[model samples]
Target: MTIAYWCVLASCLLPLLAVGYAKFLSSDSDPKNYDNNNPRDYLAKLKGDGQRALWAEKNTLEAMPLFFAAVIIAHNTGADQATLDALAISFIGFRLLYIYLYISDKATLRSLSWFAGLACCVAMFIISA
Candidate 1:
């Protein structure tokens, strides 16, 4: 309903999007290969952009819970909605940039973008109180 809520949705879905891209580009094109539960086996054939995409997707998933919890805590704790919305948008923006940087092999910029997204998550808590 709110921007923060939508951002949460976006955050939840972004990793899926990244992995979808990676899977589509993987050497194993048949969807049946995905039956394997081992991540190493599932992604063993990925290389270059595909490998980077997989890593980015995993990183985004790892970060998802923190952002989700942070945004919800901020909203429930009566943090300013406008500020929460801004931070939510910033988190998404930075994450998108982080994915792009990673896929493009820009390690330094990707790390900076990662920090910015994490900062946005931290700011949600800071602003809540």
Candidate 2:
């Protein structure tokens, strides 16, 4: 598979990773009362690191569709594979940094990282055109 395709796979996992991080850090919370079927409420009750992880998961989930669209759209439109691969790889790196920054409570840097990743998606579309 192409690097861009691999990036798509990696991007897909970020939210799951966040969910794990949130749940693990939230061990203190009573799982039985957590409204297991309603994760939003459960995550909302988390504090500190768990809260941070929850938000990171939310952010990653929000970014996933755009990244997927960028990769698929670029490929379908016959954009240069090498260029798309490079941009997609960059997007993955930025997303990783974004997750780390979010977990570390570095809001400004995380926002910047999110912007960079979004830029990558935007560039992919521009390149395809």
Candidate 3:
């Protein structure tokens, strides 16, 4: 598969990292541990970085369909392979930065990264046209 295609796969899995942080790394290990049976309840109780991580996971998931469509449409419609790959990489990089900034509670930078990532998706669609 192309790098852009591989990036799609990577994008699919990226939420795991945030959810992992929210579920495992952020919580106390005792009675307040990750609740498999009531995961949402457990997650809802998180604050600060944990809550931000959960939000990051949710936001990433929400962004995926547009990204998936952009990459696939760009590929099928013959966007320049190298350019598509670069944009795909940029998207991933921006998303990674977004997640980190979110978890770190850097609101302004996180919004910038989010917008940058969205721009990459839009670029993919435009390149295909």
Candidate 4:
């Protein structure tokens, strides 16, 4: 499989990382605080960085479909493989940075990272055209 395809896989899994951090590692390690029986409820109660991580997971999930389609469209349209891979990697990088910025409460940087990731997605479509 191409690097772009691997990136698609990565994008699909990226939200899991955010959710894992939000649910398990963000803070409040007391096991009783976690409501496995009602995970959504537990997540809904998260605050500060935990809440930010959950939001990051949600936003990442929201972005995945378009990025997936963009990569596939670029690949099938005979866009340059190397360039496609680069953009895919860039998207991942920007998203990782976005997650970090979100968790760190750096709203401005997070927004910039989000825009950069979106730009990468748009570039994929442009390359396909």
The top-ranked prediction according to lDDT is 4
Question: Tens digit of lDDT per residue, candidate 1, span 18-83?
Answer: 787777755444466664577567676778887898999999999999999999899899999999
lDDT, candidates in the order shown: 0.88, 0.88, 0.92, 0.93
In order of appearance, the predictions have TM-scores of: 0.87, 0.86, 0.94, 0.95
Clashes of 2: 0
Q: By summed lDDT, which 10 consecutive residues of candidate 1 come out lowest?
A: 26-35
2 against 4, candidate with superior TM-score: 4
Tell me the tens digit of each residue's lDDT in model 2 across 1-129: 889999999998988877777875554555566676887787777887778878888889999999999999999999999999999999989988988888888999999999999999999999999
* Shift in Å, residue 50, candidate 4: 0.3
| All models, RMSD in angstroms | 2.5, 2.4, 1.6, 1.1
Clashing pairs in 3: none
**Model 3 CA deviation exceeding 4 Å by range:** 27-32
Decreasing TM-score order of the candidates? 4, 3, 1, 2
* TM-score of decoy 1: 0.87
lDDT of 1: 0.88
| Candidate that beats the other on lDDT, 1 or 3, i.e. the better one | 3
- Tell me the tens digit of each residue's lDDT in model 4 across 1-129: 999999999998899989888888887434557888889988888888889999999999999999999999998999999999999999999999999999899999999999999999999999999
> Alpha-carbon error at 93 in model 1, in Å?
0.8
